[model samples]
Target: MKIVTWNINGIRTFKSGIKKILDSFEADIICVQETKVTRDLLEESTAIVDGYNSYFSFSRGRSGYSGVATYCKDRATPFLAEEGLTGLLITHEEAVGCYGDQLEFSSEELLALDNEGRAVITQHHFTGADAPQTLSVINVYCPRADPDKPERKQYKLQFYKLLQSRAEAILRSGSHVIVLGDVNTSHRPIDHCDPEDVDNFEDNPARKWLDHFLSGALENGDTEDQFGNISQKSASGGKFVDSFRHFHPKRSDAFTCWSTMTGARQTNYGTRIDYIFSNRFLVENVFSGVDIMPEVEGSDHCPVWAQLSCTLLPSPKFPPLCTRHMPEFIGRQLKLSGFFVKVSEKQNILKGYKESLPGSQEAGEIRENMNPVVQGNNIIKKRPADKEAETKAHKAKKSKLTKTETKPQNNLLAFFKPKQTQLNPPSPELNPDPGSESSACLTNAILADDTHCNSTQTKSSDVALDTCVSVVTETKNQDKQDKETAPVEMCRKGPCSSFWKEVLRGPPQPPLCKSHNEPCVLRTVKKAGPNLGRQFFVCARPQGHASNPQARCNFFTWVDKGK
Candidate 1:
């Protein structure tokens, strides 16, 4: 199994094109840092790669900032995936839950450390001759400490301490751990291109921490002072081994990151801040080789991969989080057209619209045709003569009904009228007030063109007729009002469903998509173009191949094109 790690800078830079580049890498598991996207801004192409199962962690405090993602091939998918070093961020039931003794840091501290969306942990089983062994891969994008910000320096150091605690906790939980990503700190002068120019480089706090964090096999190159005394190290030994340096310790200028603004990468003037650290036992036994791919050119930091000799054990009990099985991607793999296309009434037996048509076959006849009985020699078919005879009989019956139907409208109205006994004429003295509500209702119903009374009723006085007509008028008006006020059912199935609901409520809705008739989702332009930071709208459906039934259509419209 080949496991690769890279800080892609900004994942949305690829957007819909990321999938093709991901497929080109051909790694079993690829962990990317600096995704710079929130959960809301996630695109279909990035979330649901064709053959990979992905887990993502987004910054809760910021948008288009620090984030990380892990993509595992379908065959190499993990049984469990968790986000953040803190136990607070473990969303999945299957997790590396043994977060032993973090009494040093308060609950608020733990939450603050993980709020930047830095880490994603995935657990897999690696099988060999013996019983299957479990391994945890913690992918992290460590915080970069700015020299100007003293508080940031403390935060970065705290992150490292929290990270170390989590790794040790996982180790104690019986799972071998592989911690990898951009450490953002060069451990020694050999790892940095221009280490000699910097004053007091060895005194850097992060480098000092790395010296003690890595296994004792790597030498701590402490310079001798003028008094000929060696500086004492912080710790005697460390828990993890740097995989790349383990294989090529003496190899010079083996940098993994560069400054894009200075074009330092062109001159090979950079530092090796990215790493893949594993247990010494795994480095010796399971990992066959570890190397960097400097040729790949999407980000300033290139990818570092390790080849493992062990096979990835599959777990049916806990299936991997593949796009096919995930709630957001399932059924949404189709294009927008697939959802809006009209379905035929004949498709449902309960509708029976086709069977109700004149000269159409009855329900039993249609069922008989569906399952035909075979004769000895000749195949059975509905005779043309019999069909013509049935059509003629249908026409004759229709004509006879038409002749008998003297008052078809009254007959239909009578079905809705309640049965009532004949009433005697109202007394002359018992007269209703013309200005009362019931009197007004009676007047309106009698004057209305659609109102009618049965011939069986006596030629009653106006007062008696007024009571009967008022009840019918109110019932009809109530039914009419209900039909007019009922809300239309909106599409409620998709990743963007909740977003669309909120978008639809307040402002005027965006123009409906031509293909799906769905209100397009709003987006902003962040790339280097003429329309940078410009807002626009596109289909809200999940992205997929054009052939897919639920994939979004190519509907593009700028929110303010003139601007």
Candidate 2:
């Protein structure tokens, strides 16, 4: 059985179609640290892998920070699993039943340590030589001592102490313990790239604690022999063994983590803070090999793994808590499609429900009259008499529509129709007798209301009649002139009409960014500065790290100033 440990930095790193990356390791069990995922944010794709069963411990105090997960191959599922090293988070069934002594720390301190989701422990049962053995794998992402926060240094030390107590307790319970993850401290001068750069390297509390914990020695000198060489039999002496050093104790520059901001990984300048530490008995007997993989590049910390000589044994008691058991993937829940489509006997059940309700007989009768009835697989049509009656009503409606269309046109129809214009007005049609023509002219002038018809009565009657006739002729000429100019006026207004299509056309294309040759996006300044409320164009891509290829470029220009 092979087990690998890695700090994936954040579980979301697997979201970009790289979830299968875990399978590439080919290890029986894979432990990840700094998952930065809360229980609410968990996803099916992240939790479920093709051939793996996973268990996750999420931060109870925060979201998107400090979580751990373990993925074991289906065949190598653990017999027991629990969260937190303090033993407070475990259920009675899978609990390790040991937490050692906690009298040195207050209750609040113990709660604070586990609330951050720092550890996940899984016990795999295996057979060795004459008897069955249990190996407890403790995956942890230890807290870092922030220089800005002086209190974190003490917290960090306390975390390390709690971790040591838990591992020792598991050992006391007859289970071999394997503690692995980002320890957040380089134990020796050889673990760091620049030993001289760090003042009083051995004086660091975390480093001193780790040394004493591994050797069970109160003093640093007791860990090494008189010749300054580390002993090889420390694993069988009831103490933890650093797996990488157990194989290559003097290996230098074998760093697992680097500073991303300084580009230190390019020069291979880093420290070996990530480790896979196990019991000396396992390293000496059941373990075949152990090493670090610095070539892997998804995170700042690389992967370290250890292999066992024997195959893993499956648990005979309980099933693994894998993604297959999760509610989202269990395939038992109702879906939206179930409501729209008939499945199984649901349609029959619904029909029975309708029939069982009060006043359902009347509703069923109405339905039978309007809709076809289902008899076995065939649909029964409406009664013959009912069909005949329906056909007669349709024919009467069609005949009424035909009669309405064939009727004579009404005078109102002609009133709304457009009238044609004539270039020359036709002479007025009237009787040839002078008296009749005079009367016709007076009638036409009265309808036109020509101001000349309202002239003073002192003038001769013949002269007044001539004035009315002249006024009527001038009105005809005026009407013809207005009709001839109407089309020209309409054409002039057409070009200035406020069309919706024109309004929606919006602004023209913006200038392209120089870096990616992509169109820039317009943005308004929101900060309280000289350019507040001013518009500008910037690269369209989202903001990201400077080294990220998909991150936005530094192309920017004010809207008023063209680039």
Candidate 3:
């Protein structure tokens, strides 16, 4: 099997030269990122040659944002489908699920995931080889939070952490996995080529992109996240091998992607950010003929291809395949921008697992090793004020430390200060001023998982790590009850089939939102179908980023249907 991954930059452009491009590579399967097309256009996106089946995953909120697509030869595709929090993949035609009969997710949680269509996993049944091996092909267009925006940088970090957990789960399920896409981060300095920008990385530049943070391995001379423990490795240890590097050990200049603005491609100054990663077992199956195709044209990124020597046993029976969710995209000329979160979604998911899957070791361990800092991903940060703010905060912190260091040990005021004592532990969010916030709080506020920090203003840096961790631990103890109360079908079918009513607590309609008592308005689904015209109430002030609490609580509601 010969598979390739490329960031097409845009699907429409890629389509114009699709035939010529595919013929040049002769790949059995080609996965493209940033396809720039939404799920609504999935049926119309069948322009690829006659023998291939196309699958896509689209972004939820913004149109023409992050999107991915895969074209697999019919002969190589035994069973293909998409998977995400939607609980099931919804298509214009019908809905089909991956986890068998009962949905493994709650509707509310799945609805929350509808914002980002970054992940799409499809199963391909290969019958031509030895034993029938089920392969899970996951394609992702990871968030590229530019540094100019602090929030987006944080978002990208959170996205990577989430991706790690999801991939780990797939590996645990005993599946052959091949993950491909625009990973966005060049694994090593040599993987990238920009003399001026490259010099800035002479000293370890983990801050540029937490490479070790994403891979779960320790980068030389760095032990913690660039901003402290704002991010950590997947509990699974990120068992992915960069196939390009694995195949060509000495080819430092062999870049798979280049920058358009810098004329980097013209001079061949590029980076191998787009990748084809395989699991430890699958790495042995990849042939040595992996090629980085710089000649292909359509986007700034070129294609990376690898041949696999594994035996693919054909399946006599295939699962019922259906349309996976493909949200939105951004082609050339259109700008792509957004705030990214740094915290791990697994923290919440792990908490849920601990309660629901009682005695699950993975959940317990992840919680125990949880990092207190929350960060986001993106392009190199562009916010100068963030650095200035951090600097002023640091100076104030230094002065406070020096004063405390010289002060009498038993000063009466020491007891008066809440931080010195355990009784009045502070809530990081309560303090909004950056200069006044305690250094300990700053660390915890930025690193603490979502349960405690979400609002940009509320993400504080005053409370100590122990205080924040203790608070999180206590919150975890009560989360089984406080977690979002989603409405589930009495029968895991569709909307309720029977008219039913049960006594409910509190005012019938929600009082103004508990986050911001702001006015809320009704929003409708624009996609096609029965629910396409459905409406729900949401907060008036759109934060654009839902990773925050204001956005989370700002949008919440659903209508029940009866027989």
Candidate 4:
């Protein structure tokens, strides 16, 4: 089984990085830190890794922040801590107040205890060659750059102590465990690039803290020695050794963390702040351990992985049946779908059809039938001398008579050839104007005032006026209809309009920051491009009573009335 530990920074943004690592290492179990994704985000974010089961613990911060996740390739049942020792639920009130005050608290009360907001443990049962084994995996991302002035050092110390205590508890559980992550500490002078930058002992705070944790003598027959010389024998009497000292016993100076600004890791100018520690008793054999340094943009940290063989046991079996009788329905369907025709072959099939068309055959037949017969155009003639001469004379006379008669007729016909006319005769309708004086007089008499005239005149005049008014009204109505039916030219207006429209159409709400009681908004600084300017948005209600600058708002709700 291969196991890997990497601090992926932000899992959503670092998915490609993690994918590349997973492809190369192919570790059975992977532990990641600094995932910076919530439980809801994790479901959508990691859907690409098809054959693996994942366990994640997100920080209490709005949505994306310090978090950890573990992935197991095998289909193993995962066991997550109800509330792990990371103090994920420990409230500030509970921590400061007496035990009695916090004794009656529910799970909600533990939220106040969350500090650095990292750490998660996932257990997977493995069937090894020997017995059914359980592997406990832990991922951690410690706090960096303390804020509190006077107690910063003390806080770091206390954090390390908590971590060590948790690690001890896991070890005592008698399960095979892999405790690996960014310890945020350099153990020796060789662990960092600039060891002389500050006072030697004071500069390496993490080293001092770890040393203090391992200082007291162990009663379990394990001993803590100086740097480059340390070994631990497990309760099962199996010896687990550190590989760094074995590979480079004389160097005394190997590092892992590097300065991103200077590309220091490439030149071996960094510290070894990350580690992968394993239990000795469970490991039957250790193959190798190495840090992967692929040339990639983003993130300063490198990934480390290990390969080992362990004695595995058989998993519990419920019942046994004939495995060979299983159905192959999906597999057969996929196999059939995989067959396809090549472009060249398809083109050939189309060409064959074109050659067999009715039009092609008809054209070919017409060309064949048009061939001229040699005998009809210029036939071979046999002749007797005397008779031939008489025959020729007779033919000449006949030809002459025919020409004489035909020539006169042809001349007459040529003389009578038709000449083209330029002007066209007018049609009968155009010859006489429809609206003449007679017609106009008749129309006027028909439409004259009716009250002083006969009965027919009265009725005709009334109908004519009514018809004219109706026509006019219809024309006005048509014009109004045309105007109302004109096409509207849609304009996007501006970036704000488009963005706000999308926000309104999408999820109706944003995540709220628990502490500030305001929405959480993600801020990003990135490289610039043409037609693209930097983006920054203040709270829509900046001066409102509930506004908080630091608070996060990942969701936005549309205010239909702009209230």
Q: How would you encode candidate 3's per-residue C-alpha lDDT over 339-383 as one tens digit per residue? A: 332457655666565443222233444544543323465433233
Q: Which whole-number lDDT from 0 to 100 does residue 59 have in model 1?
A: 83
- Model 1 lDDT per residue over 1-563, tens place: 88999999998556648778777777788999999987667776788777777888888777688999998887877888787888776435667676767899976678778888899988999886689999999999999997768999999999999888889889888889999999999876778876765546668889777867877543324223421211356344788888887777667788899877545676676889999999888887888888988888888899999999988975554333333455555665657765453345335642452323222224444445433456998666544458778998999999999888865555687788888763333334333577875565456565764356444556564455656475655656755665565433123334366776666555335889999999988878877768888888888775544555676688988885433
lDDT agreement with native, every candidate: 0.75, 0.76, 0.58, 0.50
Q: Over the stretch 300-400, how does candidate 4's per-residue lDDT look in tens digits?
A: 66666666655222223211110111122112335564556676865664565334322222223433433333586783444335787899899999999
Alpha-carbon runs more than 4 Å astray in model 2: 16-19, 197-199, 216-238, 316-331, 334-563
**On TM-score, who's better, 1 or 3?**
1
Winner on lDDT between 1 and 2 is: 2
Where does the lowest 10-residue lDDT sum fall in candidate 3? 322-331
Tens digits of per-residue lDDT, candidate 2, 222-337, equal 34553143334322243887878766766788999987744567666789999988877887788888888989887888999889887778865433344566566777977786
After aligning candidate 2 to the native by TM-score, how far in Å is the CA of 188 from where it should be?
0.5
Off-target runs (Cα >4 Å) in candidate 4 are: 12-21, 43-48, 75-83, 86-116, 126-130, 147-153, 197-199, 202-205, 213-253, 280-298, 311-563
RMSD of 3: 33.5
Candidate no. 1 TM-score: 0.56
Give the C-alpha miss distance for residue 174 in model 2, angstroms. Answer: 0.8
Report RMSD (Å) for each prediction in the order shown: 23.0, 16.1, 33.5, 29.2
